[model samples]
Target: MSVLLPPYAEALGVVAERDDNGRLVLAMDFAAHVRGRPGFLHGGAIAGLLELAAIATVQDRLGSDDRPRFKPITVTTDFMRGGRDKRTYAAAVISRLGSRLANVESFAWQESEDTPIAAARLNFLLARATGSPNR
Candidate 1:
């Protein structure tokens, strides 16, 4: 089945892929749709990228138990540096997981490990999957 996307993610052109170990890696390119300035990515777009990556990471870890639904109850994003107009990579790790709630943290970088782009914390409501996928 195809992966699902959140509303803001769809607007900013977020893409999700499963790695060899079945982990989800969400990525976004700095395009006109998400450019804050001439070449920098918008802050909101960067947040969306981080948030979606975190959510998808939680979903992947939870397995197919409940159809994989995630709603952000709270999202705190720390904008460290400006996201350059390049292919951005997002990686997320689950901080805590519960039956009804999950907390995830993620980071986005331009290329090198030292060049941090953005960091975020997200709270997700784990329930039955809902809504339609973004097409």
Candidate 2:
């Protein structure tokens, strides 16, 4: 399956591709635009990447036919380590996709998924159709 990123994600240089194991991966290369502190990435950039990854995962799961508007209710991010000067990759797991809410966990890593530089947990409020159950 393929994913389409939002314009902000595109402007941030986020790309979606498959890893060697065929697992979907979202990545962004190191560039001056994302650089900070001389050789590290800005925390906000990494956070933005994490957010986009979560959104992408949710979008892919919902598919085009079931496009329900969703808004973030909460976003919590943990900076495990500073992002170095290299490409960063992110992937998200949806913990719950309920009738009116969704919970997603996203991680950003550089070399391996085992060692994540950052992680985010986000809760979203989903807006369903008029006749759909909100419960």
Candidate 3:
């Protein structure tokens, strides 16, 4: 199954792929459209990547379009360093999934995963899909 990212993610050229561990990883190539300052990726773009990664993680977990819906309740992003003009990667993990809420943490990095360019925490409100078997 694949996660259906929004149009904004398409505009950002976000690509989803499986890492060596068979985990979801989101990637974006740096372009003029995604540049902010002289040579750095736009802050908005980084935040967008984080957000999309989170949504993708949740959607991939649910595994189907007919699964429950998750709506972002709050998002907090931290910028650690400027993203250079290169391919950037992001990965997210669900910290907690509950009947009514979910917490996800995403990190964006370039060159090294240990050194993150940015990170984000997202809270989502979960709504059960009508007549769905999976919770």
Candidate 4:
């Protein structure tokens, strides 16, 4: 399926592709726009990528027909290490998807999955699409 990312995501050069496990992965290339403090990535950019990954994951799970409108309730992020100037990747795992809410966890890494640079836990309020089947 084709994923239509938001304008900001496009502007940031974020792309969605499947991993070896057939799961969606969001990737961003390091550039001046996302650079910070010489060679590191800006914190805001990393957080944005994480948020987008979470949203994309939820959308993928819901499918186009049953897709719901999402409103972010809260996002708690932890920075483990500085993001270096390189290709950064992020992916989200849906912890829970209820009738009206979703809990998602996302992580961003540069070199390897074992070494994540940042992580975020996000809670979102989901509104069922009009005329859609009830969950």
Candidate 5:
């Protein structure tokens, strides 16, 4: 499906790219626009980026003409370290796929391969392909 990102996400410098395994990779470069405490990235901004990445992964897997509207059922985020002024990557994995709901877990990391900056667990209620809300 043709998914057009929101203007706000675009303006924040979030870029959605695909990896070799077809996983959706959402990335953003640190700038003054998203600073939380001086040089650190904002928590909300990270959460937003993670959520966007998770939603996009679900969409990419669901296929064309299928809109997956995710309501943040519950998200527990752990800030492993301060997100520095560098490009950050967010990756999502579908943990459980059901007919009504899907559970996803995502991780955020800086360029360093040795450490993860943050991680999050997202529970999303997946609507039917016809756009029917889960009951």
Candidate 6:
């Protein structure tokens, strides 16, 4: 299935691909627009990537038939390290998915998966698709 990302994500040069484990991996290329300080990535850009990854993960889980509507409740982000000038990758996992809510966690890393530059925990309120029996 094709994954649809927002306009902002496209502006940031973010692209989606499947990892070895067959999970969605979102990548953002470092550029002047995403730069901060001398050569580090902007925190906001990193957070945005995490947020998008989280939403995509939830959407993947819900599938096309369900077509669930998502309302973001909150996102807690932790900056683990300074993101250097390079391509950064993020992947999210659904911690919990229920009829009314979803909990997701995403992490961004550059050189190594063991070393993450940032991480975020996201909570979303899910509304069942209109005309769906569950709705």
TM-score of each: 0.81, 0.90, 0.90, 0.93, 0.87, 0.92
The alpha-carbon lDDT assigned to residue 81 of candidate 3 equals 95
What candidate 6 gets wrong by more than 4 Å, as runs, is 129-135
Q: Distance from true position, residue 61, model 1, in Å?
A: 1.1
What ranges in model 3 sit over 4 Å off? 129-135
Candidate 6 per-residue C-alpha lDDT over 33-107 given as tens digits, one digit per residue, 9 for 90 to 100: 998887999999999999989988788777776667777888999999999989999999899998888999999
lDDT of 2 by residue, 3-88 (tens): 87779888889999877876667999999888878899988899999999888888788877776776888999999988998999
* Deviation in Å, model 1, residue 26 alpha carbon: 1.1
Tens-place lDDT digits, model 3, residues 72-118: 88999999999999999999989997767789999999999999999
Candidate 5: misplaced stretches above 4 Å?
Answer: 1-3, 128-135
Q: Candidate 2: global Cα-lDDT?
A: 0.88
- Comparing candidate 2 with candidate 4, which one achieves the higher lDDT? 4
Q: Which residue segments of model 2 deviate by more than 4 Å? A: 20-22, 129-135
lDDT of 5 by residue, 38-97 (tens): 889999888878877778877778877666666678898888999998999998889987
Evaluated at residue 126, the lDDT of candidate 3 is 77
Order the candidates by lDDT, highest first: 4, 3, 6, 2, 5, 1
- Report the CA-based lDDT of candidate 1 relative to the real structure: 0.80
Of candidate 1, the 10-residue stretch with the lowest lDDT total is 126-135
Model 2 TM-score (2 dp) = 0.90
Query: lDDT by residue for model 1 over 85-131, one digit each (tens)?
Result: 79987879998998777889999888864777889989887765454
Candidate with better TM-score, 2 vs 5: 2
Q: What is the lDDT of residue 83 in candidate 4?
A: 92
**Deviation in Å, model 2, residue 109 alpha carbon:** 0.3
Worst 10 residues of 2 by lDDT: 126-135
Give the CA lDDT, 0 to 100, for residue 6 in model 1: 68
The candidate, 4 or 5, that scores higher on TM-score is: 4
